[model samples]
Target: MGGRLGGVGTGLALGGGLSYLAPQYGMACDSFKELEVVLPNGTITTASATSNPDLFFGLRGGGGNAFGIVTRYTVQSHPIGKFYAGTLVYVLDHSQAVLDAARDFIAYNTNPKASIMATYEVLTTPDVLLNLDKFIVVFLVYDGTEPGTAFRNFTQIPHLLDTSKPNKTYTEVAEMPIPYTAELSRADNVFRIGAHRIEGAAGLQRPRELYDRYAAWAAANKGLYVYVALNLYPVARSMTDASRARGGNAMQMPDGPWLWVRYILSTPPGLLPGVYDKVQASFRAMVEATPSAPGLPLFLNEAAADQRPLSTFPTYSRLQQIKRKYDPDGFFVNRTGGWTFD
Candidate 1:
């Protein structure tokens, strides 16, 4: 949705992805040296730490569309080297253990080089519910061959599959079979996505509850859709430390480790007429049922339409000022697709 290398530009703007590497090298925006932007009037300008500093600050971690067209991004580059990468799969039978391990891993592990994205999903078909097909797919990566003590909890989990790759190039890892895609056509009908925050000592309970609710919701509405998946991505605050080090950005994160929970549901086009309202309602219910840490922000790239990613930013007022300064006439505001401060 944000442009590939898989949302590399938007990730820089929203303080998303690269959480595992963030504490070390800072976020994608920390290295953002320059951007060539075409404003509403077709005026072209360059922004960076040195020139047009206000727009530079505004562009970093401020959701796209609200600003202007970024013709080119001049970013600081890092050396490409071999790294460890792998995928691990486990059946739903190990859900309890896997969930527990994920909680513990984020709560205790302090390694800056290691990162893991754990997704618990139940694939669906027309006749079958796909529980037997449920899987907790985990992506593990480290700057080195070994993920070290930080990832032992995940490695030790009983699993049905493990395809760990060592010394793989960044491009190879990017090309790996990650489920994220660029498709926009709803050949499968509308997909309702939802995002929520999960954190703290209740991290274990909140996630379990959300998973159970989504499971029940899908089961009750199973025949209407093809699949529903719950994705859990870790949001470590160490990433924020890095963001702030680079003069900060718009995404003001809460303290400690948190989980960016997203629910994805698919329904065949026009299969169930007028069902979208009910479906969206159920999605909202699931989000409302989840417990979120105070001030936790949404990752704009994955957020649902109704979810207020802009309001979640602690720097809301500052962002509004920047928006006014750049586009006082609200040309971008009326024409863009993001949640604006206005």
Candidate 2:
């Protein structure tokens, strides 16, 4: 049940894992039964509910490198079967429609069997002719063979591509969205996230405006980035229920049925020294403009290096205490690049 639907792996403990099965089960971090890591003072130890319980608490949903380097993880396992999932790519002309559909899904969806991630991506290379670069890609997954009406809203939209199929393995479902590893690693990457509650019309409508604004910003400043994308991740009530059932996570997440809009912009190989900073600042400001809903926890894995994702956690104060206890002298705080505990 613990996997990259929210993170990559054992590191998920730090990032607060949100899996495709999060609604049915719980976050990936919630699956951890035990972990062995090298603590700040170079002592190797184990963390679990009955063992180094304090470390275990802080380690789940707490950002990494500040606590310890986890060498092994003993996680709870679940039965799995083929999934119904795929990716749908829509033309920019369908942007508003797709966004509307996504909003509707977020507002009312209660199905523990279904999961979706909507991303509007813009290719920023100057030579990429036409408006072909603009498109929206959605990842839909149903735990069973038939989704029933869970994804009706999305499937109704006019899309340019559809890859969803029945009876696919968990790994295949994860791989539906192709990984651009080389391009991602070599680029200048920047990420920012905004969490919002799924409220009435006004609250729900805000992200649509934010989406339009993001696209316009990327379009105006083309060539400065290899690509800029706006991704929408839903936090359903079922997901929260599952997380809470497992004694809650380090985030101490409040009630769910919310949204996290992830902002990602990557610059091509090189940019003039001063230009890079300015562009990044602009991107940061754009995300900050929307802000997160009060009491909501931002996803650490998707957050920017400069953002204080930990501060948004309801467990902030206690996490600070645990941070002081585990790395007393602040060696990790001084040496590593992560959220500030102070």
Candidate 3:
């Protein structure tokens, strides 16, 4: 039942399946290739990069829920092997230093073989802080082998408290328990509210002052607010760039090198509304404090509701044209609203 597909093939099938059926299958935005969609009036249609190329590109990352009902997909496959991956945890007191180090490490990261994800957390109980209050940086080195060389390079960081063994499956690595999964789910009715913020006008390139203010806010609101996880992924340039060369586009995001930062704000259900408002205000203030730049495009699935319109569709006019040509009736619409074909 298992097979490997190239990024494009993988994306189409995966993205289509998840959007239509199991979201738990995760998103296939990065692996889309072709789609079989059911149009209004029960008409069935097929699209690929070669035939009906416009619809193919539009569905790639134009978002699934807003692109008709995809029933089948033909994706490209590839040979994938074992990879080296693990997480490193640190204390809350060192949040700033750890974040600074992680940012520096990623900004200059040149290892084509290694990928890293760095995250931060704020805990309610001092005990949770004592147990898991630190920054957890997950490192994955894809060399198709175990105990790869990248682990050695990462171990050089003096502050790391612990590290996991190298050889692991991509599924194993991706499914690793992120911070506060249980608490996050329990605090809100919709996972949408509990999801991370990694895109939009709120890019990770926050100014030093904003970073400092956020840290101070976390410290002051300790027990009431719990968990802020910032994730930074170092995907191989070849993986993203190749998609573009093949007529696939989502990866053509902003120019500057960027890190994906996710802030997970949670409070007990009873205290949720007030805390949510405060956190939103803080986040908004943080974005307003920074200068605007076309740094990174928002990952639509993970984006906050009020992000800039163009962040999701960098080429709006073009995307709209594709939408019009394929979805003439505009039957496909986003659950959160705002997207229009005309």
Pairs that collide, model 1: 13-61
In the range 173-274, model 1's lDDT, one tens digit per residue, is: 655565532134253433333334444455557667777887777667765655667777665667666667767766756555666776666655665556
Q: How many pairs collide in each candidate, listed in order? A: 1, 1, 13
Model 2, residue pairs in steric clash:
4-7
lDDT string for model 3 (1-342, tens) is 011211223333322221210111222443556679875546788877676777666676666545566788665544446766556666555555655565554455445455555655555555543555545554433445554454454465555555465566666655555566535457641111111122344433342344565566666666555455444443233434444545545325442344433445555556667677876677555544543334344544444556543344566668777766666766655332643443
Best by lDDT: 2
**Model 2 over residues 2-95: C-alpha lDDT tens digits?**
5644335556556887777887877788888888989988899999988999888888888667688888888889899989999998888888
Candidate 3 Cα outliers beyond 4 Å, as residue runs: 1-30, 126-134, 146-153, 159-161, 183-185, 189-210, 254-256, 272-275, 308-312, 334-342
Displacement of residue 233 (Cα, Å) in model 3 is 3.3
TM-score of model 1 vs. true structure: 0.87
Choose the strongest candidate by TM-score.
Answer: 2
**TM-score to true structure, per model:** 0.87, 0.94, 0.74
